[model samples]
Target: MATTLAQARSVLADAGAFGFPVDVSRRSDPVVGTRDSSRPEPFATLPRESAAIAGEVLAGELRSSTKSDGSGEYEAMQLLRRPVARATAAATLGAIDDDARNEVADAALDWVDALGPVIAAPAPPYRWSRARRQEDAARKSLEGRIEALGDPTPARTATMLAAGTQVPIAAGAWLLVALAERPELQERLAAGEVEPIWVVWEVLRLTPPTWATARVARRSLDLAGVRIPEGGVVVVSPLLLGRLPNLVPGGDGNPHQQLARLEVERWRDPHVRPGAWLPFGLGASACPGRSVGLAQLVALTKWATSASLHLAATPSTDQTRGIFPRPARIAVVRVEGGNT
Candidate 1:
């Protein structure tokens, strides 16, 4: 009566080839958990298993290099790539079988190793709180000098970008959409009427801007006249689906309004159903590190917004992947009047 997990994956892959969007509607299939389902509950699980493997590779390589003191050319590259590698590893681990997980991990490590140095590191060394505070403080001081000079500084830009600040920019955009309908929420935030921490948690619980994701069918799947065959990956972009007109009550055409309605339906009250508004994903192949990712995003957003940091405007689009859709060039400016 239902399509097998393997069948669905095959369908997704095939559909991807033909440029068809995979339909991720609940009517089509159930979201399955990871292969190692016995480990723990989704939210409580530590990404340690995945993180350790990645860290080993990353740390090992850095240790072996002549610049192992954390100041060599490799340092900047590691700073930029490590998070991406960790996120990718976590996502891959969540999506694959146990056997494939190790392989993917190894492949990712090798890929990172091969990438050499980061031409443009994403964020500054100081932005990563994990780095020594002195380093961050010194970098912050230097940044002030560079800003005063009014000259473009690649290193500073790279460091800021790499420091995880960009995540909040994306989060803020999403929050703006959420606040559009509930102006009161925005007012409360501005007036300090609501606890900032609570707001962060609420935003985390809210589904991402995009909802469903699709992959192509590699082969024909013959169900009771459903017939989703090979080479037909019809993915539902959650952004579009979450805002789909029919899903909204009273038929408002605005995507933001639909998003607000969905949020209310899913999060505003208790006793909500489990599978509505799957922004991260649903089924066995959902993004595993979603909790950590959301945590990082919320933390980043709270810090940026509270400090009155303004981000440079940039274009962001979903390239059909359902996991992360963020803006490309999000520049930051401190309203407090210092280069951070």
Candidate 2:
């Protein structure tokens, strides 16, 4: 049978009991252990690394734009759409042949052209500064709100945002997009066969883009009979759990449907079980920008749906995990007169 939300919470709590204590303050002394060493270390330096990579990528693309050749221009356009490739381009450019380097440069250039205007227009002074002033402004605003409420706890803003906005916005946006794209789902929604909120829950539950998350074990634990030593690290994923036969109907219950129900419940009443439905992570380590990020996502979805957008014939699907699961390319085009 499908695990009820209560049952899932129990399982998660049991796992957490066997897991390591989370240090929200970031002041805890680092501890070393065998199982912990096997997992990917937290990329504490990611913010800096991302800034540097973005800078190099933009510079490389801009340089490519100077070329007069049509092929170079086309390559630049391609690169402009795939900003993530810039880092790889920068790393491999020197070792590759002229043709390969040019290709990389062109793609980088294209990506820069497409996305640069958006970045540059927002804060001209911060151009190339890498300070991310807009995000800082939002964070400060959120912090002030927390302070006014007399809650100075670390990550309080992040927690509020995750529960109040991020999850809801992501859930809504993803579902709306799915409905607009999938005719059967759209018909179902139109016919009032499924709750709109449930649609969002189902979409996220079934297609969570994030593959896994790592956690440290506070003490020794057993997983499916495998003994894990204390201070060991464990990676947990709903993707794997959802696929377990015993968790689904016919075997047990449909994990996807159960997760969907859980999401719907959480969205409707976050306080009903705080931190249990943590696609954004639980407790102190939850993402800080989740609110604004979800807002952006929701806005984009609203625009797409209103414009009657359709995905490109060959949209890209390569996704990588960050703070959350996200699509690599969610291309869509407005269908003329399709908006109702």
lDDT of 1 by residue, 1-340 (tens): 1133333333333322222231111112322222232222223233545444433433333233322222222122223233333343433234444444334333434422222122122333333343334343444443443344353662332232222222332443444334433546544554565544444434433445333344544345553357765544445444443443343333355656544542432333334332233445444345544544454444333333322222233334442322222442222323243112
Prediction RMSDs, each to the true structure: 16.4, 15.6
How high is the CA lDDT of each candidate model?
0.37, 0.38
Worst 10 residues of 1 by lDDT: 22-31
Off by over 4 Å in 2: 1-11, 20-141, 149-154, 162-173, 209-211, 250-309, 313-340
Query: What is the Cα-based lDDT of residue 205 in candidate 1?
Result: 38
As a TM-score, model 1 comes out at 0.40
lDDT of 2 by residue, 13-118 (tens): 4433333333222224333344443322221212334334434543444334333221111221132333223333333222344454344434333332333333
lDDT score for candidate 2 against the true structure: 0.38
